[model samples]
Every structure is written in structure tokens, then in C-alpha cells.
Target: MTLYGLVSSFYNQKAAVHAALRDNIDTRTALEELRVLVSQSNAYIAGRKNAKLAPNRMLLQSIALYLTDLLKTFGAIEGAEPIGFPVGTNGQNVDLESTVMPYLKVLSDFREGVRKIAREQKVTEVLSLCDMVRDETLPELGVRLEDHEGLPTVVKLVDRETLLKEKEEKKKMAKLAKMKIPPSEIFRSETDKYSTFDETGFPTHDADGKEISKGQTKKLRKLYEAQEKLYKEYLDSMQNGS
Candidate 1:
């Protein structure tokens, strides 16, 4: 079943947490927090922004989330409470290749480790370590992890919309590519002829019948040249990528 389905049926975190622990041996508050953080951060990282989110932030969050889930599934966390958690005596196999399933292993490992530790429970310290791991490892993994299909439907929809918009833009550009515009000087000459029309009774010229200044003409020519260069470069890039 989908996570949303399970979440709705369960009606609360407690029920969902219970089910997550159902197949496992043990659970921990730290582990739960870490998992929840991973889930939340993944959504945040997946969200659209005016500017892209930093690559490091996205990678680190995915890795941390993946690791936490993997440990839990592996039954590795030590010093874990038995009441709310499930122990894995059946030795259920974990699939690391499965996009979302691999994270359970991270949770399992953490649980087993906590169980072995002789020290008392330290939620803050453990969470701090999780945060540190996330921060330290994000940069290294950000370059490697590709965005996957398990994202929210909204994200997927946005991606499709963006692609369609690009197609429309390309079509518009192609249409414009065939059109020819009169030279600026020709356009200005026509405008100047009409500038002295009988209706206004005021001279449109600033000082004389000058159409436009040399500097303005030069600036416009530079702008047009830059745009042409940019369009040529874009076409070359498309060819190369193809």
C-alpha cells in the first residue's frame, strides 16, 4: 500500500510508528526523529524554488534518511525499548536497491547499536550525531544521487509542466526565427517622417530632426549582436547535447 494510504488508515504517527516497528525488533526516539527528519527534509529538498536548493542539502538529507531507515530495518540500534518496537527474529531481507525500502536497514543498525551501548539513553547527543553525519556527508553524495520517481505527485507534475513549457517556448522561437524585421534606421526614418504630423502642433524632436544619437545606435547594435551570439551558442549546445 502507498504511504498515504497507510498513514490515513493508521490515523496518527503512533499507528504508523507501530506498523513500522511491527516487523522489526526494537525502536528508539532518536531513530524515529532521524527518520522523520529525513522524510521532512526530503520533501523540502524536492520542493520547487525560484532558485534551486543547494545540491549539498538535498544529497545529505537523502543519505541521512536512507541510512536511518537501513539501520532500523537491520535491527542494529542498541539500548532500544522493547515495548513499542518489534524485533526481527524472522530475518527479513532488506533491499538496498529499492528506492525507499533501503532506509529501513539504517534504522535496524542504529537500534542494535543502542542495544549494545552500556550508557544511558541520550536522545540529544544521538540526534546531534545524526545531524553531524547529515552535514558532513551531504557534499560528497550530492553529486552522485539522482532524483528519483518516489517524490510527491506535485513534484512530478511540476516537472512535466516545465517540460511542456519548454516545448512551447521552443516552438514560439522557431516561428519567430522565420520573420524578418526592418533595419532600425529604416524604422527610425519612418518614425521621423510622422514626427512632424500636423495634429500635435509641437515638434517631436528634442533639439533638431535627429532620428537618434550615435551612442544609442551603437548600444542597440551591441545588444543585438550579443543576442545573436547567445542564440547561436544555444543552438550549438542543443546539437552537442543531442
Candidate 2:
């Protein structure tokens, strides 16, 4: 089996076993997480089919390694101690052959089939495969796989685009909010656009700069004037009373 095949199978088996044997553990949740990881791993491979990364084989290898690592972790956690598997065989004692092997074989078959189809078929096929494994096989294996409506996996697949768009939208909304409600200017501009005074006895004509509308400026001035008047009136009343 291919490395990808092996890795996917390893996790798939562990999840299945945990679901079967462990009554106390939330096997359903565990299976769902494993399924999502495998789905994402498969999607990565699908992307690498015609990806343009330099030394692209390294990319695929890296993904395979990541998958292997995840599977190894799962195997360790789930206590995938093999029963009849031979020792000194160099394979992990993680139910590698009996439970994981058949899943690997199925994945290999799917990969070969997809390879035969057009390059565009890669994503569609991988997604379809993920759905199939989650829906059909997980049920048969008595593992409860949650239906996130493919959202979690899609987020992983298109993470950059989605994250960038979300960031930009937040920035745009913040910009709009800033425009609606101005922030206090701590530092003045080098050349104050509103300043009419010119240095070095120069006659610098000023064009009208964009300022707060006349109505807003008037209201602010009125508010400050009212406050000052109220303070003065209060002082006068105190003096008279004294």
C-alpha cells in the first residue's frame, strides 16, 4: 500500500476499534475527528495531483508524513495492540493488517480510479470519497461520524482564501466605522491643511480643506458655549448668595 493509503487506514482502523470496544469514551466524537483528519489529508493529496509547487513531490511526501504522524498518535492513544501480528516485522503493532489494511486497499482503489479520470476530477473525487467513507463505511463499522455539512473540511481546504476574505471584510467595516465616528487625532499633520498661518513671512494661499460640516461645527461650538455660560452663571449666583 502507498504511504497515504497506510496512514489513512491506520487512523480509520483505530477509530473503528475505539468505537467498537470503548463504551465510556466518546467514540463518536473520536471517530468524527479522525474522519475529518483523513478527509483533509485526502484533500491535500488531491490538490497535489497537479499542483505547481517546486519540488512538488516533497509537498506530497510532507503530507504523507503528517498523515502518518496523526495515525501513529491515534494508534498510540486508542491502544491498538495487535493480537496475532508477527513481531520483528517492522510494522507498527496498531492493528495494521486486519482492520487498517482493508481500508487502505479501498483508498488505493479510489486513488487509481481518480487518476484515470480528468485532472479536474481530483477534488470532486476526493470530496466524494470523504463523504462515502464518512457516510457508508463509518456506519457499517458502527462508528458515529458527525455531519458538519462538509464545512470543517472545506475550511481546511480553502483556508487561505476564506481567512483573507474575512480579514479584509473586518478591515473594511472598521474603516467604515472610523469614517462614521472619528477618532481623536493625537498628532497634527506636518502641514496642517486647516492652518491659515504661513511661516517665513510667506503669502501661502489656502484652499478650503475638507472639514466637519458647518452644521456639526456650529453644534459643537454651541455645546461648549452653553457649558461655559452655565459655569459662569453658577459662580455669579454663589457670589451673590455669599
Best by TM-score: 1
Across 1-242, the per-residue lDDT of candidate 1 in tens digits comes to: 33343334324444545566665634665357446645654554445231333334444444455454556566664323321222344574333234332453454345335533523565556755543433333223321112223321111111334455555686677645622222222223445343432232322332356554567557655645655565566667568984
C-alpha RMSD (angstroms) for model 1 = 19.7
Worst 10 residues of 1 by lDDT: 150-159
Q: Which regions of candidate 2 fall more than 4 Å away from where they truly are? A: 1-21, 24-26, 31-158, 183-242
Number of the top candidate by lDDT? Answer: 2
Which lDDT tens digits does candidate 2 get at residues 1-242? 34466456656756664674466766456656656655765655554433522223553455445545545555533333423222224544344345555565565456445634734565666667765664445444333333332121211112244545555686777654434321222112214433332342221222355444567557645644554565465566568983
Model 2: number of backbone collisions: 0
Q: Estimate each model's TM-score.
A: 0.25, 0.20
Which residue pairs does candidate 2 place in steric collision?
A: none
lDDT of each: 0.43, 0.46
RMSD of each: 19.7, 20.4
